[model samples]
Target: MPANLTPQYHKAEEVYKQAKTSEEKIAALEEMLRAMPKHKGTDHLQADLKRRIAKLREEESRPKSKKAAFDPFRVEKGGAGQVLLLGAPNAGKSAIVARLTSAPTQPTPFPFATQGPIPGMMAHEDVQVQLVDLPPITPDYFPSGMLGLVKSADGALLVADLSSDLVLDDLETILAKVSEGRVRLFDPAVQTAGAPADSDEVLLVRIPALLLANKGDADGAQDRLELLRELYQGRFDPLVISAETQEGLDRLPGAVFGMLKRIRIYSKEPGKPVDRSSPFVLKEGDTVLDLAARIHRDFPEHLKQARVWGSARFEGQAVQRDYVLRDRDVVELQVDL
Candidate 1:
C-alpha cells in the first residue's frame, strides 16, 4: 500500500522547514505526525520522524551553560501546569497569588509591588498548579519579558482592576502591547482563530486566557465591571473576583486547573499497590502510550499491555497501548519478558 499524507501534514512540514526555534520545529513535527497516515508503507517514515523528534526534544531539555549571562526573565516551569497572571498595575495579580499560595508576593496599597516573576504552587485537592505573578503591564511601561512568559505558559489570567473606572482602557492597553509583541490572548471558549503569524523575529503564540475582574469588593466596582463586560462583549468573558475579601476565590483553583486542560495519572508496578501521591500530569486526551512515553522515552517503543483502575469498564481492566486515560486514573504497565 502507498503511504498517504494530508495537506495538514504538508503545511506542518513547511512550518518545520521554516521554523527558527526548536520549540516551533517540535510543534510542527508533532502536527505532521498527527496528520500522517499510518500503515506499513509509512512505518519507516514514522520511525524516522520519531527519531528526529526525540533528538530535538533532548536538545531542548539539555541544561544551558553556567558561564552564559543569566536572563532574569527566564522561569523554570513546575507543578501540574504553568499559568501566567497578567494585568495592569494594582490589578490584584499579586493579591491573588498571595491569597492562593504563600508565595510572599506582598500586595501593597500601591501599584507595581511585584517587580519580578514569582512562581508559587497553588494546591487544589491532591494536585498543585504553578501560578506565576509577573510584573504589571502599563501603557508606557509594560515588561517586554512578560510577553515571552505568557507565550510559554499553559494558561493566563488577564486580570482587570474593577476598582478603577478605566478597566476597559487597561484591557485595550494590555491587548495592544501584547499584540505588538506577536502574542495574542483569546478565550478558547469564545473564539477559535487568531491574527496571522508574524515574522521569524518572534514566534506568535495564541494562549488560552480568562479575564478576571479583580477587586470586586470595592464600592461601585460591580457597575464598572458590567460596563467593562459590555464594552468588550464577546471579546472577553470576565470572572468577577475579590482577592482581598476572598469573594469568588473558592472557585479560583478549580478554574485554574480547568483552564490548564490537563489530567493526572497514577503509575503502578504490576502486582504492587498503586501510588497515588505523585501523579504524572498529562494533557487531556492523552493515551496509555503517552504515559509510557512520560515514564521513559524508550517505554513507548518497548513492549506491551497496560491495566487501568479508573476510567475503565471495571477495576484493574487490561487496556491497549492507545487506551485514552482520564483524570486520577491508575495505570500499570507490563512489558515483554
Candidate 2:
C-alpha cells in the first residue's frame, strides 16, 4: 500500500531538515508520526518514523565523552510506566519526588538545585511507577536533551509553585518552550480522538500531563490555583498539593497510574497458584494471544486455549486466544509444548 503522506507531514519533514539539535529533530519526527495517516498503506512509514525516534532517543541518552560530566539525564524506565516531573526553578518538583519515592533528593531553597534527572519509583497499591525529577525548564536555562527525556516519558506532572505570583507565567513559559521543541502537552478536549484512519494529517506528540500546584498551604496559594484554572482550564487541569506538608500527596500515585493508561496481568501455571505480587504490565486492550507472546515467543503459535480468573464470565473460565484481558486479570495459558 502506498503511503499517501499529507502536507502536514512534509512540512514537519522540512522542520526536521532545519532542526539543529536532536531534540528538535525528535519533535519534528513525532509531529510527522502524528500527521501521518494510520492505515496499512503507511505502516512502513510509521515504523520507520518510530525507529528513527527510538534511535535518536538512544543516542541522546548516551554520554558523549569519558571526561565529560556524568549524563544525569539518562534514565532507564522501570515498573508499570515512566513519568517525568517538569516545572520551573524551585517549583518543588524534586521535593515531590523525594516525598513520594525513595530516591535521594536535595530540596534546597535555591533555583536550579537539580541539575540532572533523578529517578525514583512511586508505589501505587500493588504496582510501582517510575518517576524522574528533572532539571528546571527556565527561559535561559533548559538542557538541550530535555525534549528527548520528555518524549520517553509515559506521562508528565507539570509542577508549579502556587505561592509565587509568577506561577501562571512560569507554566506558560514551560508550555511554550516545550511546544517550540515540538512536544505538545496533551489536552483532552482538543485531542478527544485519534487522527482519522483515511486522513493523512498527523497529530503532534500529545502527552497526557497533570498540572501540580505545589506549596498549596502557602498564603494566597488557593487564589493562585483559582487563577490558574481560570486562565488554562481547557488546556490542563491543576492538582493542588503541598510536598512540604504532604497534603493531598496520597492521591498522587493513583493519579499517575490513571494517566499511564496501563493494565496489569498476573500469570499462573497450569496447576499452580497465580503469582499476584508481580504482574506483566501491558497497555490497555491487550489480548490473551498478546499475553501468550509475552510469556514466550512460541506460546502464541503453540497455544490451544487459556483460562481467565478475572474479567471473565466465571472463575477459571476457558477463553480463546483472542480473549481481551483486563487490569489485574489472572491468566493461565495452556499451550501445546
* Candidate 1 weakest ten by summed lDDT: 193-202
Q: What lDDT tens digits, residue by residue, belong to model 1 across residues 149-257?
A: 7666778889999888788889899989988976778876677534334333224566778888898889899899889878878777788999989999999888878
lDDT of 1 at 335: 72
* Candidate 2 residue pairs that clash: 34-202, 34-203, 35-201, 35-202, 35-203, 36-202
Winning candidate number (lDDT): 2
Tell me the lDDT of model 2 at 288. 84
How high is the lDDT of residue 31 in model 2?
78
Per-model TM values vs. the true structure? 0.87, 0.80
Compared with the true structure, the alpha-carbon lDDT of candidate 1 equals 0.81
Off by over 4 Å in 2: 1-71, 187-203
**lDDT value, residue 219 of candidate 1:** 88
